[model samples]
Target: MATWLTTFSYWLLIQSFVITIILLPLSHLLVSYLPLYLFNYRSHDSPSRYLLFITLFIPFTIIFLLITDLSHIVILLFFVWFSVLLGFIDHQTGYLPDLLVYPLLVLALLFHAMQSNEQLLLAIYGALVSYLIFWFIYGFFKLAIKRRGLAQGDIKLVAAYGAWLGVYILPYLMLLSACLGLLNYILLWIKIRYKPDKIAFGPALASAGIGLMLIKYFKEDWLIKIIL
Candidate 1:
């Protein structure tokens, strides 16, 4: 099994390079037009260059495949692809367009369905519960502060994550994302020496969700072995 896994890992790595090359141009186009068409948001004149973008995800894709099962590669790929795109868009424009988030939720439900009816049910419950919880937080915070504490897009994104990860993981997802956001806030404050009116939460949420998946699907101690 170890020998087969090692061989398969190498094969997958090569395939990932080919896949990333194909995905790069298409992803660039999607990022460029999707927001323009769907949300009337302007695309950046100078988006991150292709080389830099590829550099960001290549290591993540490698670690993702090394730990992921062959059976899950397709759905997980979509999850990562959509989440990364959403993260990038939000970071760039401060908008998580429904065009992306809704499809993300639907795909996650379909992915859960492929596992079992029970899993699908859990995903539904997870989505509903997560949405309500975040919605409440948004409402309460807004009432207290006379400003929107969380964007509607971020609330929906959290619900989509619950759909993907199931209800059992919602607390961990929220806690980790909060910690990440707080850390980001601290760094931004140090850099600018004042409280910024707003900071992007989408990136932190996306990173936390992916981080939880790595923990959930950890395959042996392969990463540790490589580090040593």
Candidate 2:
């Protein structure tokens, strides 16, 4: 058992390194070109390639080491990859392309569908309910603040999280994301000495979604205690 575990860990390390090398340039190209394709203009919001590589590598390695189930690892890694890419795009350009998000939503539903009927139902409910709730909030904030409080893309992103993680995680996801957003706002204020006009919230959503998924799967009592 020990030998098998050692071999598995070694191979995982090599595979993750190779995958990160391949994904780094690919990620760079996507972030650089996707904006031009979608909006007919280039964006300067692309994060540093080195930073992107590190971000991908760390998660890839950590997930590979933690998840023993091959199927779950594949699906979770794909989801994380998408989350990172979407987060970066939204962070840089303040836009979330439907091209990426719609596909992710469909994939999440399909994944749940394969699990069982009950799980599929939960995923569907999650998506629909989250969309409606966010839509109402968006409208209310737009009316109250005289400006759009959340983007349509953000609503879709939240719905995607519901579909991926299930309905039970929605409240925790929202709370964590809200806390992260406030921290982001405060940090930016301190750095710039004023409130910024906009915050790219998709990153916060993506991060919270990933964190909640980890907590859900690992069943870490101490982690859950800290989070809740």
Per-residue lDDT tens digits for candidate 2, residues 1-228, read: 112244467788888888889888888888788878897767755668987887778778767766777777777778778888898888878899898888778878877887899989999999998899899999999999888889999999999999987888889888999998888888989999999998989889988988877677655555465765
Q: Where's the lowest-lDDT run of ten residues in candidate 2?
A: 1-10
Candidate 2 wrongly placed segments (more than 4 Å): 1-8, 220-228
Please report, as a residue range, the 10-residue window in candidate 1 with the lowest summed lDDT: 219-228
Residue pairs with backbone overlap in model 2? none
For all candidates in order, the CA lDDT equals 0.79, 0.83
lDDT of 1 by residue, 158-228 (tens): 99999988888899899999999999999999999999899889989888877775555553456634522
lDDT of 1 at 169: 83
> What C-alpha lDDT, on a 0 to 100 scale, does residue 191 get in candidate 1?
100
Q: What overall lDDT, based on C-alpha atoms, would model 2 receive against the true structure?
A: 0.83
Best by TM-score: 2
